[model samples]
Target: MSAPETATPTIPDYAGDPNAVLNDTNAVWRHGGPPNYSNTRKNWEIAASFKSFLTDWRTVDPNKYTFVMNGGEPQSAEHMLRSNFYSPLNNDFESSHKTFKRMMPTFAWEVLEVYSGPPKVAFKWRHWGVMKNDYVGYNDKKQKVRVKAHGGPIDIQGVTVATVNGALKVEKLETWFDPLSMFKQVSKDNEVFIDEDSA
Candidate 1:
């Protein structure tokens, strides 16, 4: 008897708003960039996580999985990006609508309902930063107003924000990068979420 032909796992198609991508108007920019594939497992973790969220792809529960294990040995950067990063990004992009719904209760509920990209849960470690300038409702002392975003309290402790560069400047120091860090050693400083001013 012949074995049954198994179907290949496919990524879902998602559309994005041109303005949000080009201008970076989305709320996620407040934290930093979108979630990225840092390793093979993280990539798959995100893929599986989001796939579970999708109404259509919920049925895909593959028994056989691919991953590297306990040792410090690592996979090639390109391979890591291909397998891990793109998959979750693609999945989130498809379900941005639902993602926003899941996220809205956690953060400031007043901003635009539609989102341009993935949520901060999808944010790579690099996006975490300290605020440089004062953001309205972002700083409690100044405005004393609390707003929520992405299903979390924005003004809460340890919730990373773009830290003040000086008095008026808000900047993000890249503790992590997508392209270069993929292959090289992850800096000790990068590993620790220290003061945001240091780049």
Candidate 2:
């Protein structure tokens, strides 16, 4: 008996503009290795790396606005904390805003890139400060946002990939922002976690 023909899988079609925003090319290097990183050194190294990324992002495409995060919206870490999303104390809000908007931007927030993982899970709608700073609550007190990230093997062919809990709510830079549809689209595209072992 002849073996049945195996159908090649095509990338799942996401229902929106892949170019409409929410993305990047890649980062300089991957984060890993036992001897390569120590806790203190890793933190410092990552901070330095991120700073470098911000510098590059600013000059990358000057002809076009370099929006930082998914969909490249003009919003910043400061705007997010102060906005109705998370209610920070007015003074804290202003201070945080200044930190992200002014101080951070001074480092050229333009070149900042999202650290890679599952594109969908990694490409969230939240502001940069929320992701980078301490926004998520901790042991009953406020703390950094606790997001779950998985790594490795993935087939780059498809779009309907991964799932991020609050991804949809991220603002879009297009004609309109539809968090629900965008989330759905990403989910269907398989944009989330691609098992690093799946090569």
TM-scores, all candidates, are: 0.18, 0.20
In angstroms, the error of model 1 at 99 is: 21
Q: Write the per-residue lDDT of candidate 2 for residues 102-196, one digit (tens) a residue.
A: 32232211112344343243322221111122122121123332222112211111121122222232222221133233223223333333233
lDDT per residue as tens, model 1, 28-61: 3222443333322222223333332322221122
lDDT of 1 at 134: 21
lDDT of 2: 0.27
Which portions of model 2 show Cα errors greater than 4 Å?
1-53, 58-60, 66-199
Which runs of model 1 end up more than 4 angstroms from their true locations? 14-127, 138-199
Q: Could you tell me which 10 consecutive residues in candidate 1 have the lowest summed lDDT?
A: 134-143
Each model's lDDT comes to: 0.25, 0.27
